[model samples]
Target: MRTDRELTPAELDAFGAELDALRERTLADLGAADARYIRRVRAAVRLCCTAGRVLLMFGWFPPTWLLGTLLLGLGKILENMELGHNVMHGQYDWMNDPELNGQRYEWDIVGPADFWRHTHNHLHHTYTNVIGRDDDIGYGLLRLFPEQRWKPFYRRQVLWATLQALLFQYAVAVQHVKLDKYFKGRISKDEVRPLQRQMNGKIVRQWAKDYLFFPLLALLIGANALAVLTGNLVANLLRNLWTFAVIFCGHFTEKAAVFPAEVLENESRGHWYLRQLRGSSNLEGGPLFHILTGNLSHQIEHHLYPDIPARRYAEMAREVRQIAARYGQEYNTGRMSRQIATVFRRIWVYRKPQAV
Candidate 1:
């Protein structure tokens, strides 16, 4: 079987058509019972994480503020890595209840889902690595190495990519919000609903509770204000760094392909999916890594079927790879350390080409 690059346009189209048919047939064969089980497990994991946060915030078993804050950060990291991503993809909708389905977007527990949907589903899924179009490129920060032509700084150092990843959430959030405003001609009423809804008494109450009430209570109860503040900040920084690093390695690593805008624009769904597989790799082994990182190890499968539960992703990956092999596409995968190293190298040496 010839590789993706070896296939001509006509050959690529033919392969895509066959894969589309196969995907439909496979989805039709999925058992409702299995889907339900997957959903139940997803819900259970989410609930456990939520409970852990509540315990960290309110339980009296441990009086250490630092430990409590660290636990809270860990809880958030676990939820985001596992339940949050799957829920956004609607993988937990086996209940068939509209309310339950919509609960995935309840931002109070999981952060804003709309932002994720816009970036992940609307843009990244469609464009993959299409330079200016794919939001995953630099997560809206520095230019992806392949997209950077004249940035001398990026060409000099890839370790800076790690620094970019450290601040990815803020960069992504700001960029998406601004870009949506710019392209859509104005902010839609729907887009601001989340912020507006939070402007009510709930915001006031949360502000008082988290900032005024909690901190004062901690100080009044004989805890050192400086220690508690420093500890909480450290925990948050560590959590965010870990989360961002994992995400960067998933897409920005060496095995990941960076496509030119022209090529990406002309690609079909099959081509885009194939590109995602080639660009992203599964990190092998480490049961703890799989659990904590949400089995994002089956990244290609997740990209192919974002709505499939993560727990089932590993099993589904084998079948998906078999299909890819039949169609002559190579499935990319590697160890976590190798992937991390690749990310650093790619970031260090990445630069856009000069315009003609």
Candidate 2:
């Protein structure tokens, strides 16, 4: 059923062994550099956010306002991508820093860390691209792959994808809600009430911080309250758009593969590794770009070694590519522009039933 060449049982064992050895080597090497790197990233996030807010207080000046918005957006991106996401992955837990504890760390996004742990950390990572299990397939909205059953609703997915990118955080926030199942009457409102309450509380807190609290603070200072509010709005919008693009490009690029439920049956470690390699794509970029992506630009490595500190992914990628080549598996990767274009094309092409 697979279009790509399959590894024999012995080859699969060797492939898994190689990857496991790489992971152990990386884990053993985690030390002061890794700790310092994450700490520095955290410091950068705070610096960007605070300085951006300070600049926004004088938003009467257009240049200051524009600079403030960009800086603030950059901070949120660093937090959402570099700091928050990786920390919540337990990537820095070995540092023994309570602040970096994955189970307890809360992110700046509207999605509760606990909810995300359930939907993303556990479910999405575990099921990955399995058709029925991974809700990330289209986030219960757009039809990104031909394997998904086509619906009349998907005709508008091109537009939906755009809006989803704009409001990406909100889409992530409500992912665990499974609204589609609720709408289909498979899950009752009573069953969803507890989760709804949790979702609403987080949404309100995030809104208050960005939309109300900061703007009100500016008003008290006799600054342009409207400017502050608008800046925050635009900043969140920037974060949404960028996060959406980086993430969509990672998983939905043209060559990325999806599998069925049965593949999980007695799936060997090597087979799981193979599935991760095939199902994920990487973005080619330099250090700054990689950091901004939480090193998820190395999506293949992240999928293979979910627990290893992501800061090491770039160097680790060289070995990973070689291993894939030796096993006759393609390591899906491309420049950001090329990958994202294919993702959009896939979205457009798969909106129809049996389009190919």
Candidate 3:
């Protein structure tokens, strides 16, 4: 069953040894440094959010309104991507810090922490870009890879991709519940019932905080209720769009591969690492961009070692690239605009397998 993509036994053992060494070195160094780094990032996000909300009180002023809206959007991005996303991945779990505990941490998005962990941390990371296995390929919406059998519905993928960005958080919140699958008989009603309940509670809590309480507070305080609501809407829109762009570019770039699930059955650890490298791409950026993307600019490394603290991705990238070179594997990477353009192109890339 082994395809040419599979490494020889000697190569597999060597590849495993080098990667094991990398992981061991990283694990040994994961301690106070990681805990402090996440805490600092959390503090930064909190400060930005507080400042944005306070500025929004003076939304009647044009300068303050623009700055406040921008800050609010940036703050939400930092919160969801850097602080919450990585923390809930158990990246900082070794610190044993209560607030950063993967199981206990709740993020700012409408998606329940538990549900997100189930879909993202467990499933997406595990299955990656296996054509039939990885739900994240296009989130069951668009055709982002030519390997997926195109249907009549795929003609509207451009529109679907746009709408998915605008409603990204809502889409993510409901992904794990899979009500459609249950209704279609692919999954059991009992299996989805508890998740549906959890998602319902999460929806109420998240929606109430943003769409209800904050606007009400502005009205009570004699601020422009319309402006308050609009500010929140704009902020959420910005977060959704930016997150969609970063995530899409990370996985759907031209150089990334879409594998047949059969190639991955009973896969070994080293081959699993190779599959992740082949199926993921990275964005080129400096520190600020890295922070904004939760260091997922180095997506290939994160895919290979999801549990490693996000802050360490930069250091690991060079080693990862070198190891990949030694193994003669292609490590897909590019600038943000280039990567994103390729993903967009893939929407309509319908072609034979050789064309890809």
Candidate 4:
């Protein structure tokens, strides 16, 4: 086992090879019964997402409309947190060949693949908890840490982000695309092919139907159009807030690491995974919290093997802790309320120097 804090070139190659071997071994060891459970869960999540989308479209008017929208929004939130996050990791067996299983474009279930790729694959995975590089800490306009120094205007950025989260649909629409382009360089035509192909006409039609056609239909139904609009807006706000709060509690809390670029470069994947584990925490409330938050409480396991299904993470976490202990690394876990309070305190107290 390599004990050095930083990997030499040869060690890096060996590490890569080891990871590949481990991945194959792990996949091979996955029990047949577990595989069946994975399939069943995937199918169930797919059904929930499909039904939620359908209901959201139709649920705009009358007494039934209000109830339907509320239920559908809750379902959407559940699917996004639980199913969508795991599915994006390619945890589902059908991911590689969606067409083979008649799986529609995944964006239909979540929001967009680009959003996942940028926020998760690129920013979160690559940077982990490095203050500036990881977009998860981008609290919109506010510099959540001292290492993320910005202009004075950033003080009010949190309010701006809250307002934007509530009202700015197009802004949210283009966020991942724009960020990827700005940070990583221009998005190649080929890179967006999945999104373009998936979205094609269906997504545009749905957007038009939902925001435009649906509202007009509600007006015609003698439903107070303003009330319907307000309800939709409120529902969306609540969903976004819930998502943001959970994510923030995990990575922006007091225990979370805020590494400099130099420290980040010195870190190994194992070390980085440990840092994320120590910095982020998991709540151990009940199955409901696990279901609603996508088993994010097992964040250490998720960081180590993102491809693992979230439903199975609790079991995997036990194994991960043993591994961490053998490696002499710390693993963090805690209650939800404590994590939330820690996040607020950290964000409020964090400061950035004018220069590194």
Going through the candidates in the order shown, the clash numbers are 10, 0, 0, 3
Per-residue lDDT of candidate 1, residues 1-356 (tens digit): 11455566677677667656655665665677656754554565556534433444443445544456666556555656665666666765654645336344443222246666677767887677667677677754445555445555544344545565565444444444554454556777777655545443344553454345555665777655445444444544565687676777667766566777787655676576667667666777666677567777777777777766666667667777887787666777778788778776665455434421
Error of 3 at 206 (Å): 1.4
Candidate 3 C-alpha error for residue 109, in Å: 0.4
How big is the positional error of residue 161 in model 3, measured in Å on the Cα after superposition?
Answer: 0.5
After superposition, the stretches of candidate 1 with alpha carbons farther than 4 Å from their true spots are: 1-5, 8-14, 25-70, 98-104, 107-111, 152-163, 179-213, 216-231, 264-267, 351-356
Better of 1 and 2 by lDDT: 2
Clashing residue pairs, backbone N/CA/C < 3 A, model 4:
146-351, 146-352, 256-279
Order candidates by TM-score, high to low. Answer: 2, 3, 1, 4
Q: Across residues 1-356, which tens digit of lDDT does each residue of candidate 4 receive?
A: 11224445555445445444555556666666655654665576566534543444454445655665565456656656665666666666434546312123253322455566566766787778776676666544556666676666665665655664454333334445444554456677677666545444444664565556656766687555555555555555556666766666667665565677675766666455545555556666787777777777667666666775666677666766665555444556678888777766554554333523
Local distance difference test scores for all models:
0.60, 0.92, 0.85, 0.58
- The 10-residue segment of model 2 with minimum total lDDT is 1-10
The top-ranked prediction according to TM-score is 2
Q: Residue-wise lDDT of candidate 2 within 263-356, one digit each (tens)?
A: 9999999998998999999999889999999899999999998878899999999999999988888989989999999999988998888785
330 Cα displacement, candidate 1 (Å):
2.4
List the RMSD of every prediction in angstroms. Answer: 5.3, 1.2, 2.7, 6.0
- Model 3 bad stretches (over 4 Å): 1-6, 188-190, 351-356
